[model samples]
Target chain A: MLLTLGIIGILYVGILVLLALRARTDVKSSNSYLLGGSNLGAVIGFFTFAATLFSTFTLLGMPDFFRVHGIGAWIFLMISDAVMVFGLIWIGYELRKKARKTNYLGMSGFLELNYKSRFAGIVAFIGVFIFLLPYIAIQIRGVAIFLHATFPEALPMWAWAAAIVAVMIIYSEIGGLKAIMYSDVLQGILLLVAIWIVGYNCLHHFGGVTAMFEEVEKVNSALLSVPGPKGLFDFQFLLGSMIAIVLLPYTQPQVSTRIVILKDIKSLHKMAIGIGFFAILVILPTAFMGMYGAVLYPDASTSEFLNMTFISDQSNLIGAIVMIGLIAAAISTSDSQLFALGGELRSILKGDDEKMVFLARIGIAVFAISSLIFALLTSDELVLLARTSFAGTSLLAPMIFTGIFYKNAPNLTVIPMVTLVALIIFVASLLNFIPNHFLGIRMDLTLLAIMTLFALVCIYTDRSKRGGAIEN
Target chain B: MTNERIWTLCKIAVVILIILTFTPLVTPSGIHKPAFMGLPYTLWVGILEAFLLVGITWLATIVHSGRHEE
Candidate 1:
């Protein structure tokens, strides 16, 4: 299995490198490099968006989530994803309309440009860097831990992480966003194909889908209901999850950058619906694998269940495909995000285009190294860590939302205050300084509600004052 | 449809979908009493809801572009 996986990983990286080499000549300017020259069409746009949104979390974290929790896991992911797709249509249209009127390179630059406030971009960049770094590390660590478990004697966890980061940086530097998008197309296809094959095999192992669920129900009836066996999927938990996931494209730089790079509104619309379907297709299979785990390895730990189901049970070729797919998932997401961080830096830098691009690459290396260190240090729950990143960044949602939709800006003080408070609350929850769920409501949901209400009140007050002045 | 009208309707549709997802009206607790086609009823409803979302968004896009051409 290790030999097959190693050969496949090398071949996959080689294909990506060749693709990057072909795209290198296209990167004549920093704008072109960061934004893909704004030439992405429906096919590439849809796949890149899908690839970036669903990653190792889908392959590893999600099935484990389902096995440990229950069926509510489906609603937690699919519903949120469906809503996110619809959101892209409305948000994407407005964002693109705004982008066309300015030299929009990244979200931070857009915020700074539109609000006419340097601090706005600074706060935006800080919030993204803080929240997204761990999210990137989640991808890195997820794959590293899996590889370590698969080959206990092969190499250390950090070595696996460094290798993945090296691959991501080399390809990203060579081809820029263009190479990433093209590679995303390949990664997305491989992910969908590999997941379905494993899913079917798992289903066939038991009698069928019906028999599998029956077996799960017989073992633990909680697996079939809301707030499953562990009671992890309560109403409030699902609500908070929906909000975080729906706001993902707006808050996450990688997905949002893809939103702006599409060629036109028509492509964006097609891509949005296509992504919605892809979400359902990709997620349903994970549920199947989870059911397999629930009935067969009910008492096994997360890594144990994953290893048994995804690796030990499969033949050599299938195991290699799954491993490569996992690696592809990690790289597809990590590179998009790391590149977006570079784009964010480029957006804020005040220098010549060449110098700005050069600095941005350096910034990317810094971000990747930081993520590697975090991956080595922290290996928390994947889905929960990802949720924290989402909630933290969603605090900046109001800032960006107002920047795009409203003609008049609110008090600049509100942006940083909201961001600071949101991050503090999330970090506190992570450290157990505050409860994750307060009185049955998730803390992140409560935080988002408070932030949105604050933004609304400020907007209403400012608008009323302007209205009174106009009347007078 | 003008941009304002189209965007307002899109927002309304999205809000409705969200409410459906969160409310017990479409939840498995409400719907998953029986298994159908190898899935709990809640999953079936969720799938249907997703398709409805795709349908509405597609229609909105068409309306927006149709108005543009007009």
Candidate 2:
């Protein structure tokens, strides 16, 4: 197993280096370095978007989600993803049209320009930064903790985290977004192959799909139904999750950037359809692995269950491949997020292109280090933590939609201000400074509804004021 | 109908599908019988729903007014 892991790990690193060097250029303009030349085609766009959106969360967190939460995990992620892809074709088209008219560098800068308020950009930046850092941290933490558990004698958990962050920073800094996208193609394929192999093996353990459910039924019937044994997937939770996931392409800068950089609407539409398929293909296997865990390691801890199912039960070569795939998943998502953060910073800065790009590069490094530290400190609830990140970023949706859809967005600066307050309140709820629910509704859903309504009212009032002025 | 009308209909269809997903028809609590091919009720239904959505999205892309735009 050690030899196999060594061979695969070295090969993975070798390919990453080659890709990074290939992507390197003498010119380091923001457009090339940060936005990957802003002309992505369908195939590459699909892989990069898939790899970024489904990461260690899918590979690591999801099986555990199914194991504990039941088959509802499928609806929670796949249904939400299905809706999100549709949204990509619908609202995403409008966003691309609006963004292309500006010198779009990031969502923050776009909002700043459209809203005619620097505060709007600051709010956007701060909202993403606060939410995204934890998200990036969880990706690193997920893979790092798993590796440490798999090879307890090899490296400390924080050391594993630091090494992953180091690799991410090195490749992304050297090659930029192009390198990351190229590596995403590799990661995406490896992720698919590794997951299917393990999923098949897990399914084969029970002989067939029907037999598998029977075994799961014998262990716990709740694993076959909604809300599971823990009652985690109730209507409110699933609805909030769906809303957050659908808004992700617009509200999450990493994803939103992908939407804008596609070479054309044709590519965007193709990519959206491709991702919809990819979502099902990727998530379906985790359900197999989850059911496997439910029957075999139902009482085991997360790491214990993952280790038993993914490594201990698998062949040496398969385990090594899965390990590399997990690392690839972690790196693929984290680098894009850190790079997007830097891009967000660059979008807001008003200076020479070279200097702004330089500053943003530094910003990327700082963000990566911050994530590294947080990875060591953060808890290991991968799916739930990721859901929080999605929900947190979704708070920015009303403000962002107003920026994209409303021509009178400049007069609607109140939306960004309100978005900022909602963000603070949401964070407070997460920190337990406030209750997680208000009047039996989740804080995130409550805040999103309020902010969206406020935005609509603000737009209507602004339009009416203009109407009165025109009449006078 | 014009492509624009088709696109609008696709959007409305997706909204209805999403709304129905939360109801007992798709994700009824504590019901796992009526299994198809040994798959549980919600899991198989949810999978079908997801495929339906992607299928709708595919159709929408074909009729999308902006599909011809560069």
Best by lDDT, which number? 2
lDDT of 1 by residue, A1-472 (tens): 7688878878987888888987786444776788888878999999999999999888888898888887788889988888788777666677777776788778988888866777888888988998899889999999998888888898988899999999898888888888899899999998998899899999999868788877887888787777787777777888878888888888888988888888877788889889988988999999999989998999987778888888899998898999899999999999999999988888877878987888898898899999999888976478877877887888788888876666666344565567667778777887899898777767777777777777777767877867511110
lDDT of 2 at A355: 94
Winning model by TM-score: 2
| TM-scores for the candidates | 0.94, 0.98
Predicted chain A of model 1: TM-score relative to the true chain A? 0.96
Which segments of candidate 2 are over 4 A away from where they belong? A468-472
Query: Which 10-residue span in candidate 1 chain A carries the lowest summed lDDT?
Result: A463-472
Clashing pairs in 2: none
Real contacts retained, model 1: 0.40
